[model samples]
Target: MQVAQATEVRKNWSSFFDQVVHDKPQAVRRNRDTALFLSKTHMEEILSQYRFTLEYEIEEDGYYSGGLKEIDICWSEPSLEELKQTIAKDLVEYAKTYMDNFALYHNAPNRRDHFPYVMHVLMKDNIQEVVELIDADWERT
Candidate 1:
């Protein structure tokens, strides 16, 4: 293993990568061991110890208000009962999804223009084989 200062590695990243590809693993550090630069084959071997899967999902549209959309507020004085009802309604909506679940996110809209998405998780066990096939495709590209 070779040791390299993090700043030195950053300044000559291409040469560092070339060294890692042809020579040996390089340990890059600042105050402590920060990262390791390893050969592709070594990286594959390390990754082989754990299982990985390629995930595919279809994004389905859901309700979303783009951040630019704003609600207009009425400044008219309201009775105490009306104020209580408004607060209650807001509390219900917050408990249903707003408080914990709903958050702002942006992505390319679906076929029918909409922002929110429903993600489906898909996994395959043959990750290494798939990665090699993708790598071949990448080389051609």
Candidate 2:
């Protein structure tokens, strides 16, 4: 959880490598404003701990709705809390925005379709569940 400027990281690449070997991840900041991270083993370990599936369905318009279906049961690691928080925040915002937009367009429709309110509500509900799951830290194991 150490923070270093991007320039500092570039200047001390060897030290950063040593830190990674020692299981210490470093956050590199650019222009003292934006931050990036460097942690090879940590990333690999996280990836190894998760499983992913792709789910797709054909829509009425002959297009496909595809999503990454991630199945992971382990979230006990401290680093995962940040990920959970991010997911929760994103879901909450998404749900709110979708509802706002749906309200605006509930009466409008294209020639081929009816009201899209139901679909938007379903999406909002799904996002709400994601937010709740993240907040509860409800992993399978």
Model 2, stretches more than 4 Å misplaced? 53-141
Best candidate according to TM-score: 1
For each candidate in the order shown, give its overall lDDT on alpha carbons: 0.38, 0.45
1-141, model 2: which lDDT tens digit per residue? 557778877898888878767856667778757665546556545434232233344445543333323322222222343445444454455445555776554544431121232222233335444433432312221
Pull out the clashing pairs in model 2.
none
Distance from true location, Cα of 114 in model 1, Å? 36
Evaluated at residue 107, the lDDT of candidate 1 is 31
lDDT of 2 at 48: 42
Give me the candidate number with maximum lDDT. 2
Candidate 2's error at 82, in angstroms? Answer: 38
Q: In model 2, where is the ten-residue run with the lowest total lDDT?
A: 111-120
Cα lDDT of model 1 overall?
0.38
Give the local distance difference test score of model 2: 0.45
